[model samples]
Target: MSERTVIPFGPQHPVLPEPIHLDLVMEDERVVQAIPQLGFIHRGLERLVKTRDYMHFVYVTERICGICSFGHSYGYSQTIERLMGIEVPMRAEYLRVIWFELSRIHSHLLWMGLAADSFGYENLFYQCWRLRERVLDIFEKTTGGRVILSACNVGGVNYDIDNSELAGISQIIQKLKRDAKPLIKALVKDRSIKDRLVGSGYLSQEDAVKLSIVGPFARASGVEEDIRMFGVGGYGELAEFKPQTSTQGDNYARVAVRCNELLQSCDIICEMIDKIPDGPICEKPKGNPPEAQGIGRVEQPRGEVVYYVKGNGTRFLERFRIRTPTSQNVAGMVQLLQGCELSEVPLNILTIDPCISCTER
Candidate 1:
């Protein structure tokens, strides 16, 4: 029998955008088991609830992850709204959904670029990000912030897009959809790219269920679990919506699932823009939440994110907790790494789209 070796796979590496360390147990060139080491970027943001008022805490939640900032704020605000029994206007709900979908498109494009870069496709990487800039420009035009848009509040949104601007946004969405097709085709159909991703890290459906994987990672494994199916908020108002899935449960399936979602999000945004009603955006929430617990769930770009808030009948919340998608998907990531070649480890980790900052927070 060959002697076993241990290798450390970085809190710092060229491919990893954030800090995450893994200790890989190896036999020859194959990984036998992979151990994850977290907390490199922990900020203790959850504990800030006591100091910041419940209303102001929306900003804190938004800071948890820049890529999923809108989802975080949306979930936190929904939790506080539920806790206080405040009814947000239907128009506001539709607006929130529009921005949330836009954020999803922005996030998936960013990940696609990174995935392209990992495979040494420099030109493809640049093209992915160039399409993403138009999404950011839409955010800046409407919300006045690109990365951290302070649009969501306790009761509703802070701003509204007029009908004229909404039409312009729809035109931009259509243009983006047309521009992204050939790039996506190249990433999915190119022989060299598929060889690197197709069967590199195989996770069967049974294993995915056993690991409790969430978000696009879980959907890619044939799991039909999505928070939006419950018809929470504006999702119920859509004419039709379904969770995208693939049975392959490999690295390529994950890429395909996210690619499909990018188009789905654009469709959802256009639908909301067409149907949004004209009404007051903000509901002007009054008084503090009664002593009770509130839970909010949103389908973030990575997967499902849950927020738990405890109110003390005061301006200050008793407790605030977030269950980020990355935290839940980490187990499945480790599972995928097992039996993979050492050379394939980085790409396996990237496929899960691990958000270390969100997980650490």
Candidate 2:
């Protein structure tokens, strides 16, 4: 019989992008169980709603997570728009989708870089991030911010991309798609990469449903769940939309799902640019919201993010809350960790793409 041992796996590890602590119960090299500990970096951002006016709170929301920054702002703005009865122009909605999908591409590339690094593929990691830089460049040229884009406002977007620039952006996205093909192929199809990822952390489709996972994590487990399917805002304008999915429910499936979404996001961006209408981008919402509650949901790169706002018929909101994807996916992450080999622990945790800052916020 092997002796049981308890091992602390984080709060500071080489492979982890954020601080997340997990105590692993080990029987030899196998993990019997994993218990997660959070709250190491809570910023109390939600509580700030009482002090910050509803109009300015969008900035705070964008700071919730750097990678998902635009999505946070977009979701918050949608909730406020719904609450205040603001009618954003169709052009703005289309612009919002373009930026949102670009952010998705940026985020998925970032995750792929991190995954490559975890696989000890240094060159591949650099290549992935290098491709991500072009997306950031587009954001900087259009929105004036990279990580924390304050482009979204209460009624509509703050900036607009002209038709010519949109065409150029489409070209860049096409180029990115071509450049990224080989890197994605190497990461997904390489025998060595598959050996490390395939069947490493199996989360059955039944278990995924029982756990209620969201975003690519759930999609990887064959759950066809995506908030975008509701056809809200720019998504509604699209001719077609489908959630990328896989039934393998393992580390490899998670990687493949995200990689495919990267290409899908590029396609969505090009389609929006081609069909985008012309109109005023900002609607300049008037007056404060009534005493009511508003909820907004967005399909972020990691998963589904929900924002709740309670307006008190004043500039300041009565209450604000956010349910980030990491918080929702943590349970599923712990479920995957069980019985995995210790060497595979970091990869399993990375597969969920846990953002501790977003969870703690």
Candidate 3:
């Protein structure tokens, strides 16, 4: 029966990386409702798809989000390849899986650091990002670029890895695993961190599925939906692959999934090197053909990144649509943000790893 108080959360906040203005209606410092205002950085990527050729737009899509750049490029390539009715080489499929998983590891690491920073665990934040820098080095050495490394093509990967490099990668992963395991222990078992995280912003499995959550959000809540397990993007050919599931849908549970996935990605990459067949990395024949409508979906670091491309058998695409994970997860965030204390809002938002740029794109 009491009147509520209103507070403006962002557009410029230390915790939020992008300008996502949220008007929070509060009652006694508890959020009663949240209204999200977006479009601060909407670059009209959907429109650009009409102007740019399918090949060139790969870079554009990669810019959708710095963290999940590989996922965007991979998804776009998959969509175009599907529309063209082209079959990727077996080796290509395995390599794609490897690259995709490695990308996942780095993203999870980056998110972990942000989550730590949000909760005021600055020390943990620095340590996690320091480890992530190693993964970046690996990416630079393998793909020859850092963040938005365009590693995938329409039919296959852009770069190839030789036997010597494969061996080196395996050794590097083994070393990182040792370094990462201890860090994970400190995060999970550290009493101070868990007190701030474990019980806050809880989401039941039913709520997660009902909200149409994707990637780690759904899986962390016990839903077993994964694009890789569906065997769509060369994951089918991989000898080892599995969907990580959990019953607890709290921030702690999400962190566990991400930590384990880091190891899993390293494992997948090492395994692929064993069976990496000898052949071309890509399968672009005589000339790049005209565009056709292609639907490609991949598991981004945050969640699912789907690409819809319509081509008119020309160099440029007729229409391109992308449904980013953050856009889809915002609904879930509204629920998670509600009924929580004002202090916990930043942690909750970081837990979802909100990429406002991707959502607005």
Q: State how far residue 208 of model 1 sits from its true place (Å).
A: 1.2
**242-333 in candidate 2: lDDT tens per residue?**
99999999999999999999999999999999999999998998888789999989999989988888989989999999898999899999
Which residue pairs clash in candidate 3?
290-313, 291-311
Between candidates 2 and 3, which one is better according to lDDT?
2
Query: Number of clashes in every candidate structure?
Result: 1, 0, 2
**What is candidate 2's CA lDDT for residue 265?**
94
Q: Regarding TM-score, does 1 or 3 come out ahead? A: 1
Tell me how far candidate 3 lies from the true structure as C-alpha RMSD in angstroms.
Answer: 1.6
RMSD, one per candidate, in order: 0.7, 0.8, 1.6
Tens-digit lDDT string for candidate 3 (211-280): 8899887788888888777777567667756888788888888888888778888787777777777887
Assess candidate 2 and give its TM-score to the true structure. 0.99
User: Which scores better on lDDT, 1 or 2?
Assistant: 2
| Candidate 2 displacement at residue 72 in angstroms | 0.4
